[model samples]
Target: MGNFDIKDFKGVIPAVLTVFDKNENIDEVGMRQLISYLIEKGVDGLYLTGSTGEGFIMDSEERKRVVEIVIDEASGRVPIVVHVGAIGTKISIDLAKHAEAVGADGISSVPPFYWKFNENQIVKYYEDIANSCNLPMIVYNVPLAGLLGMNVIKRLASIDNVKGIKYTGMSHYEITQIKDEIGKDFLVYSGCDEMAMSGLLAGADGIIGSFYNIMPELFINIYNAISEKDIEKAQRLQRQAVEIILYSLKVPSFYAGMKAVLRWRGINAGYCRRPFENLTEEEEKEFKEGYKRIKETYKITGVEFLDEL
Candidate 1:
């Protein structure tokens, strides 16, 4: 991996979803199609194999294949940030090295979960991963990783090559504090789709969310609106995004709902892997109806792909 400027990692990065076949295998064709769709829509970056991508349920080989496919499909159009997080440190380190080897722009990992870990252990985990590879590391801050506070974040940020964080929580105050305590160049990406605007206003450098997989243009619009200092337009788009988020939550599975939306868009983003159910026929019908209502209400256009669906 070569030197990467933190500025290149900024903007509306999507925590991309993993496409799977009916047999629960990686759908490479569908995955590439989805990648093309997003790139054509103009996403700033791609976060592969994260929670939205169902990385945890996949094994090491599957994860590596995803990294390879995404990087190849992206074709240097946009930077790919592979999420190399795992329950085990060795696997996480291995994935981190693989990401760098495969030419990922950066690497990110959530603190080891499923077993209670102290702050020192969490700090050490990040330090180990950051040291494992040459690419810059982004600390993923989710509540499941034990609720990292500003103090813990500050400690982790001190590690060399630890560039920034993917903040998924609701605390806008922490976003400001991270930029305040850490440097302004510290890349803070809002992991929550509902708060894309608020996160930007709170000093977040960008956003990475599951919802971006379905409607990336909207989020891109919001980011551009904020950049142009069009607070009114940003707020309007944010409200529409939150409405879609609320409807998405009503589905049986959030990830499944997102995939369903992609399929509706003719992208062929297949179902979630085993242990996670896809939306039922009834749920799909309801979701499509709700989505139609949202599209009409928001006057969202330029998604010519949806017209065929």
Candidate 2:
């Protein structure tokens, strides 16, 4: 376990992407650069090997290597929460133990998917992982797989080491309910970039999403504005974020579009792996153009842009 408390987990944490080389292997140099970049931009923490990092798509050894690389590169500058979620309980526990061995700050896992799991099974799944190691565990509840209701959330929260949740659903009511049930000290990070403002207002402790990799300063500003009770500024930043997000969706693979933007910034974060196509030449052009417009419209500062680079 790391030295960070639950409070340290609050603020803008990026669900960082996994950089792959031309040969479709994890690019250690590129990954290190990205970790340094986000920390330099003042992101509060890093959520690694999650959906954005394509954790499920990679094998166990690949995931463990990424964790080791990120923790090593971060060098204790910021907390790193590794997503060790796998399809089976044994694999998940193995990953959790490995993360603890490598000195990760925390561990999180999505509930078992693909087959319908009863409430008991879900609770047990989380409990098994949480008990596997000393690190605190966060439950990932996204709407795509299955949404945990207030009752289930309360049950999960009751587990001693089950610390908080990464909520990716759209319901603001649920966010409030989780806080109300678990108390405000229980961390609730907004998993969707599009609803970050709404999530903060609904009492989320912080924001966590793939988009933070693009412009972390903007997201940090949003969190700061919300903390200062500056609703107008928060709304403005969120609108800009939403604009970029909408444009990103125009591409076939949103992650690929993000990688393109990074490459344009001179980061050389390589292509998405197989099954996720890279942006077409035309799509790349459109994305770059739109990204420029977003930067100018929002007057985003303190981050490198493609054109400026």
RMSD of 1: 1.8
lDDT of 1 at 228: 98
Q: Name the weakest run of 10 consecutive residues (lDDT summed) in model 2.
A: 300-309
* Prediction 2 TM-score vs. true: 0.95
Question: What shift in Å separates residue 198 of candidate 1 from its native position after superposition?
Answer: 0.5
Best by the lDDT measure: 2
Model 2 clash pairs?
none
RMSD of each: 1.8, 1.7
lDDT of 1 by residue, 1-309 (tens): 623455698898889999999899999999999999999999988999999999999999999998899898998888888899987899999999999898898999999998988899989999999998889999999876667988999999999989999999998888999988898988899888899999999999999999888888889999999999999999988987887788779866899988887887678999998788898888788778877776787775543423333
Each model's lDDT comes to 0.88, 0.88
